[model samples]
Target: MRFQIDPNDRKPLGRTGETVPAIGIGTWRINNYSMAETALIRAIEVGMNLIDTAEMYANGEAEKLVGRVCRIIGRDRVFIVTKILPDRFSDQSKVIKALEASLRRLGTSYVDLVLIHWPRPGISIEKQIQFLEATVEAGMARFIGVSNFGVENLSRAIRATKKHEIVANQVKYSVLDKQVEKDLLGFSIENKILIQAYTPLEWGGVAKNETVISIAKKYGKTPIQVALNYLISRPMVMAIPKTERVERVEEFRGSMGWRLGAEDIEILEKI
Candidate 1:
């Protein structure tokens, strides 16, 4: 399929003016640390411009692998995204320290987006936003957001950080779990906070679904392509599908070009 920048709403991840691919490549499960750099190289060669990782993923090995690949290719070509653990919120210095560690591990000076991994219980929301604002001011990250935040938490974050822009919310989005659809999805679209889908493949479950298989056959595509296409069709939504094989990366890239028909979209809606 054709690969190019999609014509969807290219909202800013924050005020950094860096626009990303509506579909990204998430490096969460490709856990062979020995081959992580090779996997990253394969991803970049195939056309994945967005790479999502986290400080906690493999105890930071993922970042190190991504760093090596980025250094070899030049950082300008890839949009690197990672999140900070919520427990570190009370101490703003920990936020900076964690980021510095991530930077050192990734061998990069700045990250495209840094999200609060999750909204931990008992921590003041104000402290979270304060650390994020301070993070941006210190140039540790360009944009800030939260992951796994509900509508109420998202609203609270927005309200708490009215002075600082909250760009997006990274959450567990897939055909199987549409909790965000209840309200978080619609609210985020209206508020200009892009919804970044983490496990766009249904966590390996979509591959066996008959409906997805049938749709893929009709489109002459793979099941993963259909699932990813469905997610990308929605406004302000991006899918980050993780895979190690070059062919699989190409398949994820394949989902970006064609527009799913209305009937097909409706069919996938029930999925």
Candidate 2:
């Protein structure tokens, strides 16, 4: 299927009636408190208040840094989303317990969203979704979803839910990696599940692309900014790019408040 986004129309969080910046902070590889502290503050100043973290990231040390940054920035100003590791999915059900640990690390009582880190072997989609439903029921998670889920797994996971709806799916999507665009992207758009794009820059690969560079020059924007904005051009999509540098956060902010031209998008489509 071919995609043609207007690029000018700003899509919301998959019809959730919530308003947040199209880009957000990703604390995946950040382990330093001071660097994350400065970076997150700058992120908020530029309207990127969403923060994505996982208990598995740096063995929960990254959540501690995000927790500290949230404290400094005032928690209400930011939308926090954290993932629960797959090992917690089982009959014994350590899911709620794990989310609590993440909450303790995040220094918050309730997170904006909670996701199953990834689908696990021998774990029923029913069980996985049930565990996440428990988090929302306990008032600890405002929404529940999954990450690294393909279309088949995502469909099964959603069907397994009983009480709450699956809200978002965090995936590795970038200009260089368009795997999700094949089927998952279209499905998520139809189902109103927001696709939270991780690694949207392909670790700086887009910066070296001649086409992306030329488009950047036309807009007076950095290649990174063009790449990030390109991801958000899709329906029900947003980006969460991780950076340890404060200046990078400022640069990331430039990705929004503008749209890429359709002609440029056509060239990017070829890429």
TM-score of each: 0.92, 0.95
Q: What would the per-residue lDDT of candidate 1 be over residues 1-271, giving only the tens digit for each residue?
A: 1122234634346444556677777878675655656666777776667789999988898888789888898898778889888878768889899999999998989998888999978888877887888888988787788898888888888888845688888888876666767787778767878889888887778878898899899999988888888777776688888876666777787887777777777776676
RMSD of each: 3.6, 1.7
Question: In model 2, how many backbone clashes occur?
Answer: 0
Stretches of candidate 1 off by over 4 Å are 1-17
Candidate with the greatest TM-score versus the true structure = 2
- Go through the candidates in order and give each one's C-alpha lDDT: 0.79, 0.85
**Residues forming the 10-long window of minimal summed lDDT in candidate 2:** 6-15
Q: Which stretches of candidate 2 lie over 4 Å from their true place?
A: 4-11
